[model samples]
Target chain A: MEFLSERARQKLKSALLILSFFVLWEVACLVFKVSEIVLPRPTVILGALWQFFPGIRPHLIQTLYTTLVGFALGVGIGVVIGAVIGVSRVAYDTAYPLLVGFSSIPKVAVVPIFVLWFGAGTTPAILTSMVICIFPIVVNVATGLATTEPELEDVLKALGAKKLDILWNVSLPRAMPYFFASLKVAITLAFVGTVLSETVASNRGIGNLMMIASSNFNVPLVFAGLFLLAGLGVALYVIFSLIERRVAGWAMRKQDFAMG
Target chain B: MMAAKPDTFVPALPPSAPERARPLISLEGAGITYGRGANAVEALTPTDLDIDKGDFVALVGPSGCGKSTILKLVANLIRASRGHVFVGGREVGAERVGIGMAFQNPTMLPWLRIRDNIMLPLKIVEPFRSEFRAKRKTEFRDRAEALLEVVGLKGFGDKYPWQLSGGMLQRANLCRALIHDPALLLLDEPFGALDQFTREELWAILQQLWMDRKPTVILVTHDLREAAYLATRVCVMSARPGRIVADDAVPFARPRTLDMTFEPEFVALTQRLRGLIVDARTGKV
Candidate 1:
């Protein structure tokens, strides 16, 4: 107990909470005599996952690959468009309304269009995820750059720095925390976009497997598919969080005291 | 030794020539107005002022007297609606070089280490910028470290801006401003947010930096005591449509100490500056 640091203790508490949640869920399913089709118990879901892991592995890889490819493209395009809109008044005024309008349309609605244009497979899934995740990244990056303190700009401007110099030295670096935050949001959205396309069009990926599982009334397998997706999402989120801590730790430290 | 031909030699100009002794900075009836037409509000009145090289001048008055506006004009951060601003014998334009500025808020880039933040200008301002990459590890880093030491932030170069206290950040802010050895230094109430003890401590640090480097400084502050303590000349401005109403030269010797602030002459000088501001605020000046 003495050897456990505060972070380790906190992590242990989280693990215990998750373990208890599953135990409670398992007990309720048994006591209520709930039908497996209606609500499969945690143990049953785990069993199905262990039994079908080999078959599920390819679908899992498909979804992960689709989401990552889409997310990387989304981040690259988002940052460029965001930097443009953030720095230029003309871009902000002309493009912002259009972007907002486009984002407001349900991403699910756009999946069929993507499938129609690209034909049913990985292409539609990748395209859907790319489109879905770009909005948050663009909005966040633009806001970050637009909100750069005038004082900071003045510090460089007084030294006769050119516009590009200011953008490179100050605006982009200042916008890093905002960019990283959007990565967390966009990463999750990327998964949603991929799955949406996969369920609607693709014959591959976890979403398609879950679709097939539900159609055959394989409740345990469906739950297992969900568990895999959730696990993958959490893994990606954790990776992004670690990267954020490394690059934008200054803003993170400020936020801790700010909350207090 | 061969004797130099008299025809090849050019005689030196007389010292009395106006061009020979022109001020480092000259505002020829310069003024600024916000917006245009019906919505326009005059911030600074058309006024003339001259500052010689290495002069420490403080602009002091009530709030809204546009003291900071004057500094911005000098830095060429904003354009004058009337007349011209000349710095280093050239009219102010889109491109202004050899200027360093610090505000009340310590505007250090949070992502950068203190040393990197101080060396920022070197990566942008020319001559140094041209050779920055080559000398960054040796010459530039040593300069940043030296300034940090001067500001009492020795060995804190690797720390982020947030890790330091408000006072320490402000001290770092001063180090950043002085690191480039700019021809002009503009400070807009840089210690305005600090506690009294911290503010007084910083005053000594700033004075030492200024005395050593001798960059022409224009400090904009509401603190009359600060104006008297640090400046060679204190210019008091009238409130609204700000104009220089009073310009008084401090009769104090160099290497001024904090203890000297308590002297009768220093006290009287600050009191007179305070009185000018009060009158300006009351519309009696």
Candidate 2:
């Protein structure tokens, strides 16, 4: 304990808290003689997950591949569109209302239309995820660009920097922290979108597997699917957070001093 | 070590003969009025001015006197509502280039290291711009580092802008402004945000940079002493519908020291400029 740093101690405390929560849940289920169908214990879920690991592998890979492809496309399109709106008042004024209106429509409502257009498979799932994640990135990147310091712009403008030059040198770099922030939000939403589409229309994926498990009254297996999805979402979120720290470390440093 | 008392009133020197024939910058009845119709606010009154090459001119007055407006007009950051502005014998237009500018805020990009910040202008302005990437690691880096050393910021080039103090950032801002060696430099109260001691120290650093480069400078400031100390000519502007009411020549010699600021003649000159501003603010001009 004495050798542990403050960060290490905090992490240890968090792990202990999570472990205790599972222990309490397991104990309560046993003490109450709760039916496995009503609420599967964490141990039962873990056991089911281990037993079904070989069979679930393909579905897990399918979900991951769909999410990554959709997310990559979303980021590429979002950055370009965001840059356009950010740099031009006309684009922002014209596109902002439409974007707001579109994003407001619950993304789950859009999955059926994607299924109709692209058919019930990986295509619908990928399209759903791609559309779901784009809005946050666009809004964040636009806000970042629009907020560039007028003083900085004047400095470059006086040096005869063209509009393109200003965009490259100032606006894009300034928007990075915002872009990374959006990525964190977008990644989680991407998982939600993929799962929702897979449940509604796809034959393969964690969502479809969970649907089948629940229909069969295999409560532990259903819970296992949920845990798997949650684990994957957290892992992606943490990976994006790490990337954000590396790319926008200056902004993070500012935040650290601000919080202190 | 007291210098002899000098004449209290020295006539403004007409831009010497040949220089007068082709002044570097001339403003003829140029004015600016923001908005349109009834909502319009006249920011600057149409007026005339001429600055010769290598001259150091300061525009000083109360706030909203359009001293900063004049700098913007010359820099072509904003268009004039009336009349014309000529730079290098050509009418100022959209394509004006090769000018250096610094603001009171010390607007360094936080993401860029100090050396890169200083070299930013070179990556845009021509001659250097055409070859900036090729020389970025070698020639440009050396130029930025050399300027850092000159401003007493040696060995701090690798640090980010946020890591430096306010005064150090201002010094870097100055370095950025002078990095390209532009023929014209516009400073809009570049030291206005600093404390008294830091401000004084910057005045020396700025003066050294100005003396060494001798760029035609147009500095907008509220500090009358700063105007008197730095500029070869100090222009006092009227409040509101701003116009230059007086253009007085400073009689100080080149390479002026901080101690010179305490001399009776220097004090008298600042006092006279201060009076002009006070009178202008009260509409007594």
True contacts kept of each: 0.91, 0.83
Q: After superposition, how far is residue A128 of candidate 2 from its true place, in Å?
A: 1.1
How does each model score on TM-score? 0.93, 0.92
DockQ of 2: 0.75
Model 2: CAPRI class: medium
Error of model 2, residue A229, in angstroms: 1.0
The iRMS of model 2 comes to 0.8
Q: Best candidate, lDDT-wise?
A: 1
Which ranges in model 1 have alpha carbons more than 4 Å from their true place? Answer: A1-4, A254-260, B1-20, B94-97
Off by over 4 Å in 2: A1-4, A254-260, B1-19, B94-97
Q: How much lDDT does each candidate structure score?
A: 0.89, 0.88
**Candidate 2 clashing pairs?**
none
